[model samples]
Target: MDRKIFRLAIPNIISNITVPLIGLANIGIAGHLDSAKYIGAMSLGVTIFNMIYWNFSFLRMSTSGFTSQALGARNLTEATSVLLRSVIVSVSLGVLIILLQYPIGQFAFRFILSGEEIKGYVEAYFRICVWGAPAVLTMYAFNGWFLGMQNAKTPMFIAIFNNILNIGLNFTFVFGLGMDIEGIALGTLLSQIITLAVTVTVWSLKYGRLKKYLRYADLWNKVALRSFFKVNADVFVRTFLLTIVTGFFTFASSSMGDTLLAVNALLMEFFMLFSYFMDGFAYAGEALTGKFVGAGDRKNLKAMIRRLFFWGFLVNLVAVIAYSFFPGELISLLTDKAEVIRVAKSYTFWTVLIPITGFAAFLWDGVFIGATLSKEMRNTMIFASMMFFACYFIAVPLLGNNGLWLSFILYLGMRAFVQTVIARKRLKLI
Candidate 1:
């Protein structure tokens, strides 16, 4: 029963691809509309949700790390228990988010977004998407569990199917039904609900035998629960910082005016697109690293890192080539606004460089997360974030929009450098 890395990576790659495919699909759906306002609105709205939900990404990351460790120890019982606890926490948080959507949207807009028009779109998008929080969060937990067990295919299936459904629904509602932003919201909402159901069904069929080991009693153990909290707390800080940085990117873009905001948003889409692809390899690293660490196999961990870094470099190289050739083609497809396209073209240099500066950081995130070195992950982010702000304040006043882009590139560079430094601290690399 030797593990085939590509076998695992293929599914993850498929699943990861769907995420940005959906984003592109959403932008495409909105692109058909007459106004750039729709484009800006959807971008702002989604960024807000991204900030909130991304902060809780630990639900997936922590669950994968913990469950993979248990599974590696040949403890199916503990694996099931770990998953159950993660779902409970994820769903509880989801409920709280849905309930506070209105106030949250208001606060986020006033504090984070720069204008009333952007706020209006952001609020409208949130109002509709809030209802789907439970489904989305639950998906995160299931995605992690499946990946942890070396079952990337299941999550990939769900991710691809969900994207297909989302795209179809978006077309129907936005164009056929004239639904607009409400359509975008409903598309994601319905798609997530379906995906969650499919995930559970797959879980039952695949990991069903382990259900017998379901021990609700274990959730009460202070020692086990304490470890869970410790890991999650560290991951939470890391995720929160991630969310805050994302928020700052959007907020800063918004402050630069509507045109630059749209430009920055489109630029972000390019970076996020590249990131989703890179995440597939990181995910492979995360799952494999967690398993190897849990089994106390440092040799295999090194092997996994070598293979992942190889693949990461190749993949990012392709992205750099793609973005370099036709940045306009991608931007035009996302929005119909000619002005937005022009601005985005002007900033293409930063987008092209993003894959280079940030690729290592994204891949290393998988490595660190799989190892459940969340405290280290948190520390890396803290340093990177501090660098982000220090660079931003000095650059923003002088360079304006270009400064923001360069700062972000540096932010990613900082993340990689800091993570590598901390890895040496933990692994005694020196």
Candidate 2:
């Protein structure tokens, strides 16, 4: 069991770690620029994409859960059906996002971001990056399907390749070619497209045989389609609420001031770093739990859950220790700006609580997702989001940024606590 968990977790951890490295590279590039506004602009741009892409993350989650279940049940046809269905939905939605990019960009700038100078840089970034929606979304589908098929190494390979290409491109465009924020955006867009092409080529070479099982009829079978949409819709709503919390966090930070925005943005990277680590294990949970559930092996399901939590606890411990002891050293890696780094130090303590409060939420999310417990997952997010706002409203007045951190911590803790309780009740039935 431990071996299986680590098999998936390690590659995922390597792949997932590269994810934040991309963000870090973007931030680090912007951080070294002359003004703090560059950092703020890049952060806002990233946040906007987060709001857009995070909602569609359902593509990956649902596909992984369904594919893993189908594979576990030895239903290759259903598994093949899952991939085709997800890719179609993802590509369609991606096109929709492109058609609607103007309005989305406008709404984001007008409502989500503040500060005039930063808006231009952000707009330039958004316009270029939005075009990658189709590629990004399509990749989401493939990555999910690959994980579900119990092929973490493929995604890891794709991710590593994408990261190296992206970082190199960003540097060449930004520093080598002397472009501004647009360079970073272009780098990302090109990387996404290339990665998508790589994903397709790899899938064709490795898993093309599965296409023999694909049936046009099964792709749209009313019952199967219903289940697919039902799970995805629930996940969509849950993910939407999640984006709200995170988006609002960025929005609120921007409202505080550019210095604070830069500080908070840099600080959040710590949370992101921690999350990628936890999510690696979570992915393992998702793959294993779905496999067990589909096989109706309740015993392994329970054992997997137990071991997942144990691993989650150890990851959290390492994160807390690292964040507590070396916050400054870590923050410095993102930016050399003295003021931003100085301001960020004041908030370093908050990150120490992140993994501690958030690890269970991450692990349970994977378990529930694998079991296809979308409703429960959605309900927990809804409740936690509500509490987050309530805490922010009540606490921010007294504590300011500290209040925001407090609310955020409570939000994480609440999600974990609620999900733990619900899992206890729900897993028994499964």
Candidate 3:
């Protein structure tokens, strides 16, 4: 079990690490620009895209769970069908997002307050990056499918290539050509398309045999489709609430002022950094749990869960230590702006606490995802989100930014607490 956990986790951890590095690259580039407005605009723009992509994360989560189960059962046809269904849903949703881009942009701006100075840059970033919707969502399905098949290395390679390409392109476009936010957007858009192409190519070479099972009639299998939507609907609601909380975080910071918003954005990179690292272990739990469930291997399932929790704790312990000790050195990587860095230092404690507060939630998310227990996941998310808003309302009035950080911390802790209680009651070791 230990070997299996590390086998799946280590590659995923490396791959996931790159995701935060990409964010760091974007922030670093924007930070070097003449003003912090570029960073703020990029954050707003990315949030809008996150709203769209993360909301549809069901494509990845559901597909991984379903496919892993099929593989565990040695049902290649069913695994292929799962991927096909996810692709169909993702492509359709992506197209819808493109069509509704204007309305989506309008809705996003309602939550963002960069004033006129930064608003134009935000809009430009959104318009240009929105074109990657199909590629972005489709890659979600592909990435999920790959993980489900226990092929983390492929996704890792693809992710590394994608991020490196994006950073290189951004540097060239922004600095070499002297462009602005649009240059960053263009780099991201182009990289996504290229990554999607690579994903398809890799699938063709490695798992092309599975295509034999891609019958269109099977694509609409009533039983399978019902299960798919039932799980995905719960995830959809959960992700939507998550988006709301995150978007509100940015909105709240923006309400304070542009410099504060920029400070918060840089700080968010810490959260993102922690999440991506933890998600590697979480992904392992998902893959292993689903396989065990599919095979009805109760003994191994119980063992894997224990191992996952153990490693999860160790990983977060390391993260907390790093965040606590090297706060200044870490945040400095994102920007040289002394003021933004100063404000960020004040909030560094929140980042230090996040890994410890949130690691369980991240781990259990994978557990439930692997078990296809979407209702449990969604219910816990709803409860945590409610607690978040309540804490924010109560604390922000008294503590100001400190209150906001408190609310966010409480939200993470609540997720871990609520989900653990629920999982303990529902999950049967036998």
Top-lDDT candidate index: 2
> Which wins on lDDT, candidate 1 or candidate 3?
3
Off by over 4 Å in 1: 1-3, 112-115, 428-430
List per-candidate RMSD values in Å: 1.8, 0.7, 1.0
Q: Poorest 10 consecutive residues of model 2 by lDDT?
A: 110-119
Candidate 2 displacement at residue 146 in angstroms: 0.6
TM-score list, all predictions: 0.96, 0.99, 0.98
Tens digits of lDDT, candidate 1, 1-430: 1245677777888788889888888876766677666666777788888988998898899989888888788888778888888889888999999888878877887764556765676677788888889988888898899889978888887888888999898888888898878888888888888888888888889889988888877756688789889989998898888888877888888777778877887788898888888888888888888888889888877777877888888988999998999899988878888878877898999999999999999888998888888888998889888888889999989999999887889989999888877776675431
Clashes per model (N, Cα, C within 3 A)? 0, 0, 0
Off by over 4 Å in 3: none
Q: What are the per-residue Cα lDDT tens digits for candidate 3 across 154-228? A: 999999999999999999999999998889999999999999999999899999987877777877889999999
Number of clashes found in candidate 3? 0
Angstrom error at residue 429, model 1: 9.1
**Global fold similarity of model 2 (TM-score):** 0.99
Count of clashes in candidate 1: 0
